[model samples]
Structures are given as structure tokens and as C-alpha cells.
Target: MTATPLIDPFQRTIDYLRVSVTDRCDFRCVYCMSENMTFLPKKELLTLEELDRMCSTFVGLGVKKLRITGGEPLVRRDIMTFFQRMSRHLDSGALRELTLTTNGSQLEKYADDLYAAGVRRINVSLDTLDDQKFADITRWGRLPQVMRGIDAAQKAGLRIKINAVALKGFNEDELFTMVDWCAERDMDLTFIEVMPMGDIGNENRLGQYWALSDLRDSLRERFTLTDLAERTGGPARYVRLEETGQKLGFITPLTHNFCESCNRVRLTCTGELYMCLGQEDMADLRKPLRDYPEDDRALENAIRAAIALKPKGHDFDYSRQKLDGQMPRHMSHTGG
Candidate 1:
């Protein structure tokens, strides 16, 4: 049976769902969370079985692509079981893709298991390549560990994409170096503008904001970047490097909004459905799911209600030397 398609208020089909399985991570990235972080209580988080049911419900509602994320999704205990169960959606052709975004610290252990469970591609959040700089950025991440994980993933036949958060005065000097490095490894690279979210202990959001437009200009000096009209069901806009022939993507949520064509929604580890990443508006699906555990109708209706209130766009502007439209929750809380 064909499930009723999930269409938002703006007429965009909500087929992509990013689910945060846990709010805990081993590496506390400077941009994502504070060095000394307080994670969500385990009791408040949905159990792995609950997560499976919630995701399965979304799949029944026509969510074609599912991306498991977290502070580091691999850190979750027995997370492979969730992936193994979700693979049923793929086997039935109900889901097109099942992937995850990781910090790459745990891939060495989980990469083979991820492939066996149906994940063919993944996005690894790597801000810098320098070992010391990598440690400084991720706070607890070791570059060698991540590199080993990347090697394992590649060896396991999983496609890899490097996601780097473009920070001013930090990775600006490594622009060419990063691109060339990814190109050499045959991995696609994406540069994202720093979003204004949560408190980073002592770091200033405005100070770290790096406009992706400036970075694009810098890339133009070295490579012939021709804009490609292809979207991977997300906000990234792609460009092919004429020299290396590899694809480069730019996710400019601050400098350029990609909301008009937004076709996804984020589900937190606690089962809160966030209509927009930049907005605090969220619908508590947990209450509905837990209150009516055996009632699929109630869960479906609750999801539909949330989709109806999905905002047209996010208001994340970093202009005039100020950080406007900032959210109080950390990126790790909602899954970046």
C-alpha cells in the first residue's frame, strides 16, 4: 500500500527525516557544543526500540530518506540493531536511502556493520586536517582515529563525504588544501557556514561566522567551479571542480537561505519534531507515541499536524556584525 505523502505547508514533500538517536558524543566540537557539556538524561531519551518504532512510522508516512545523526550516533549502544531494522524499509523499496552524519571517531568499529546494515554513504564532520588543529576544533577528537575510520569506511565500500564548517580565521587558510585533499581521496566535500546556535562556552558566534560566499570566491581563484543543478534532498548546492572533476557543495544557511525548497524535518532524540532548525517551534510526538503506543492512527495524525505547521523558512542571518535568529539549543541537541 502506498502511504499518504507528507506535504508541508509550503507544498514541499517531506520525504527526508534526520533522526537524532542520542544527545551524547565523544568529541565535543567547538562549534557544535561546549567543552564541558551536559548531555540529556538517558531516561528522557527514547529507547532504541522506541526510536525504531518512531522511524518506522515516518517511513510508513512516505519518508524516503532517513539520516541517523547525533552528538555522534555511533556512540549509542546497540545502534546497529536500529540500522538493521531500518534496512527493512530499503529491502521493501519504501526508503531510497539510509545514511548518517558522524564525527568519524567510531567509524573504524562500526563502518563494516553500517555497510552490512544498508548504509552505502555517510557524511563525516571534519573541520580541519591538521592534527593539532583538529584536536583544537573537535576538543577531544584525534585526527589519526578519524583517518583510520575513514579508511575503514572506504575499505568497507561505503561512499564518504567530508562536511567542514567554514569558520573565519580558522580554516580559511586551508580552503585549497582541504579541497585538494578530498579530491585526492575521491571524496566529495561540502563547506557549511557557521550557524548561530547554542552557547560555545567562550567562543563568539559572530566571530566564528564565515560567509560561504567569500569562500566560493576563494575557490573560484583556484578551480573552475560551474554550478550544478542537482540536490541531494537537502539544502546543499553543488558545483563541479573542472580541474579535479570532483563535486563541491555549499550549504549557506546564513548567507543564502535554502528554505524555499526545503523538503525535510528534524526529529530529536526525545521524539520532538522540529519544523525548522532555526526556530524553537516543535511538536511533541513523544507524548502522542507514548500515550497511544499501539495506535498508529494517533501517531500518524500527530505527525500530520506537525507537518501542517512547518515554517516556510528559517531566519538565520549573520549580517551587520551581529548574530540574529540564534537558537538557545545546541546543534548537537537537534542533530546537525
Candidate 2:
């Protein structure tokens, strides 16, 4: 029997799913988290088997693209085993693409294994290029380690994309440098505007939110950017350098909104299905999955109900005065 396709109220065909394997991370980036964080207990996280079942349900509902994310996905134990299990779907015709987003702190050790498990595309979150500045932003991150990880991933025959969170007074001056760096390596670079999601203890620093429009204008001064008409099933809008074959992307949630075309949903490690990143609307999948472990129909019904309730757009107006506790979920918990 054919299952019904999952569609939001706005008629958006939801096909992309971002799954967070764990909320634990080693770095405490100023923009991502507070100095002190309380992570979820190991018992509270979804087991590998549960994740597989849920993903299978999503795939059955016409989800073709799956992205594995986390506070840092590599921090999870036996994650490669999970990857191998999911690779079976990709091996068959059930799945189209399987990608991952990581901080690149531990990619050096697991890059080969990830490739062997059928992961070809990767996105690494790197905020700065300077070692000292990297350490400053990430609290205790070593720039060399991340750089080594990037190199290893490239060597392992993976398509690498650098996800840089554009923060003023930090790496804003190095935007052109970053472009050049990626161009030299034939890698695609994406600059994301720092979002005010969650209590990262830096709400007062909202002035540092760099608009993507401004970044685009700045890049135009140096290089010719030709907009690409193709969509990668993600929020980022891609462009090509007229002089070189390098591609650049911008994720402007603050300056420019992309919610009208939002075709994805996020699932936290504990089975919470977030309909939108900037809103508090979610469906509790853990309870249903736990209670009806063998009932695929129940799981699909819960997910479809959540999709039906998905909001038209997020209510993140950055111009408004700072409210008390705007966002309830942090980036780590929500799988940013």
C-alpha cells in the first residue's frame, strides 16, 4: 500500500530531514552556547535502532535527503555503525542522498570510515581561520586539529563545504580571505548570519549580526558573483565566481528570510520533531516511538500530524527589542 506524502499547510513538499544524533559537543562557541551547558543524559538519547526506524518511516513518507547533525555528530559513540546501517537504504533505491554536518574536530580520525559507510558530502562548521581567533571563539578549540580534519575529509574523497558563522569584529574582515582559501582548494564556502536562537548568553551582542545582503555587496566589490538557478534542497542560495569556478553561498535568516521555501524539518536526538528552527512548535516523537516501537503506522501518523501543524514562517524579527527568553531551544539541542 502507498503511504500519503507529508506536506505542510503552506503546500511545501517536505523531503529533507536533519537528524541530530547527539546534543553533546566539545567546543563552547560564543555564538552557539553558553560557557556552561547541561547536556542530555546518555539514557535520554535515542538508540541507534530507534533512529533507524524513525528514519525509515521518514523515507517511506518521501523524504529523500537525510543530513546527520549534532552538537558535534562525531562525539557520539558508534556513530559509524549507524551510518553503515543507513547506507543500506542508500544502497537500495530507498534514499537519494546521505550527508553530515560536523564541527570537523574529529573528522581526521573518522573521515575514511565515513566514506566507506557511503557518505560523500560533508559540511564543516568553521568560524575563523586564525588559530588564536578560532580558540577565542570556540573557547578551547585548536585550529590545527580542524584543519587536519578538513584535509583528511578531502583526502578521503568527500565533497567538503565550509559553514562559517559570520560574526562582526571576528571573521568579518577575513571574508575575502575565506573565499580565496576555499577557491584554492576547490571547496564551496557558505557564510551564515549568526542567529539569535536560544540563550547563548550573548543576546546583548545582537549588534554583531552580519546581514547577508551586506556580505553579498562586499563580495561584489572584489569578485563577480553570478547567481545559480539550481537549488540543493537546502536553504542556502548558491552563486558562482565569474573569474574562477568557485561557488559561494549565503544563509541569511536575519537580513533575508527563506521560510517561504523552507522544505525541511529538524529532529533532535531525543525524538523531538521541530517544525521550524525559530519557533517553539514541535511534536513529541519519542513517546510515540517508544510506546509503539513496532507500529510503523503510529510513527508515520505522528510525523504527518507534526508536518500538518508546521507554521507558515518563523517569527524571528531581529529588529524588535530584546524580549525575555525569546527562544526556548538552544542550537545544540535543536541540531543547528
Q: Estimate, for each residue in 1-336, the C-alpha lDDT of model 1 and write its tens digit.
A: 237899998799999999999999999888898988888888889999999889999999999999999989999999999999999999999899999999999999999999999999999999999999998988888999999999999999999999999999899999999998998999999999999999877888888888889899998898898999999999999999898899999999987899999999999999999989999999999998899888778889999999999999999887867778989899998998
Candidate 1 regions off by >4 Å? none
Worst 10 residues of 2 by lDDT: 317-326
Which sections of candidate 2 miss by over 4 Å?
321-325
lDDT of 2 by residue, 1-336 (tens): 145778999999999999999998889888777879898888889998999988988988988999999989998889888999999989987789999999999999999999998899999999889999999989979999999999999999999999999887788899988999999998889999887776776555477677788889998898899999878888898999898878898888766778999999999999999999988889999999999876777888899999999998776656665542257678988888
Q: Quote the lDDT for 242 in model 2.
A: 93
Instruction: Give the C-alpha miss distance for residue 22 in model 1, angstroms.
Output: 0.4
Q: What TM-score, over all chains together, does every model reach?
A: 0.98, 0.97
Q: In each prediction, how many residue pairs overlap at the backbone (N, C-alpha, C within less than 3 A)?
A: 0, 0
- Residue pairs whose backbone atoms clash in candidate 2: none
Measured on C-alpha atoms, candidate 2 has an lDDT of 0.88
Q: How close is candidate 1 to the true structure, as a TM-score?
A: 0.98
Candidate 1: Cα lDDT at 145? 96
